[model samples]
Target: MSAATVSSVPIPSRGWRNDMVAALFWLLTVVGVLMMTGAWFLLALASLEEGTEQPKALAAGTTMAGTTLWLGIVPLVFAHIAGFALCLVATTGRFDRARGVLWAGEAVIGASLIGLAVVLVLSGGQLLYTPPDYVP
Candidate 1:
């Protein structure tokens, strides 16, 4: 075989699920950041709202609630992380099994991301800029 002869690259067989999972991984990554950021902001605002003196007291309580809500995403993040591992497996030559895991993770991640988005939005409280009378 000459150097010019090209070797065939092994392509991972992707099912609908695998594609979906990969999509979810990306989607979840975005949502996770948003959720975490929103949580931090809420906590910070609580500190500000309480003023300099009782921050320890106020922050503590709100932090607990935020943490409880934030904690819900851990498993989904883990699954999505594992889904990435499965994707690596697909790259390395295992497509069939990895695909199933990847897609399952995708669904989980997607659902979790959506949940996080919803939670984050709810947790965000009312939009401060808008007046009570304002509706559009």
Candidate 2:
């Protein structure tokens, strides 16, 4: 057959879910960076200020926001990591079944991560600094 006689081949397209997961991956990564930067700035400002009202609030707020942001995106990252691990396993095992199980595990991990974040926020946990009630 000549080059001119060749026909075009069909291209495979990804599903909406795959597209959504990709978007979330990029979005979460960017958000995580921004959140961390803002948290650092707030914590620094809180340290620089010599006050009981604004500085204390800044420290607490940054701690909560930063922790929540980090916790929220961690499972999404693990999900991707798990997906890669499954890909390695798929070299020998049943890809379809393994992918389903890995995705389900990711979902559970994501849900639990969210719940943990909510609990942390509600509990008003602090980090990088000590509470006033501390003896040290």
Candidate 3:
């Protein structure tokens, strides 16, 4: 009599779906990062301008612009690093953990971008508009 043994491999259900989801997350995060970079650059350039008539407005605008630039860049870098880490975990067959990380990173990056946009819009009045001069 002869004995035989069979080995079973773990096959994930809907593996393609995970792949697609991860791909989409990466794509959106990449685009967000690029836009953040551009926004930071523009903020820096605007902060360098010296044509504002209102000294208080100019000072406030400069500080807000610098803060917004840092806020955008730091979150982008963190998101990128987190995304890469999630990819590594995925490759190791930890799909669940990877998915969770992807969502967290996406949220962080999204919030950062939205915050930057809001800051830019709110500061536009002080930075882009000139105030009327009044004799003191």
Top candidate when judged by TM-score against the true structure = 3
**Residue pairs clashing, model 2:** none
In terms of lDDT, the poorest run of 10 residues in model 1 is 125-134
lDDT for 74 in candidate 2 is 53
Where does candidate 2 have its weakest 10-residue lDDT segment?
Answer: 86-95
Least accurate 10 contiguous residues by lDDT in model 3? 45-54
Full-model lDDT, candidate 3:
0.51
- Model 2 Cα RMSD, Å? 12.9
User: Of models 2 and 3, which has the larger TM-score?
Assistant: 3
- Alpha carbon lDDT of each predicted model: 0.48, 0.43, 0.51
Flag clash pairs in model 3.
Answer: none
Greater-lDDT candidate between 1 and 3: 3
Residue 128 lDDT in model 1? 22
User: After TM-score superposition, what is the CA distance of residue 90 in candidate 2 from its true location, in Å?
Assistant: 22
Per-prediction TM-score, please?
A: 0.30, 0.27, 0.34
Candidate 3: lDDT of 3? 35
Q: Residue by residue across 1-136, what tens digits does model 3's lDDT show?
A: 3333343566575343466666765565555555554554445344444224236656667423344345444555665565455444433333465555556556546645664665566666343333457689
Q: Candidate 1's residue-wise lDDT over 1-136, tens digit each?
A: 8655675775546543466655655565555555544544454444344343344656666433333234334444554565455444433333566555654456445544564565457657531222135356
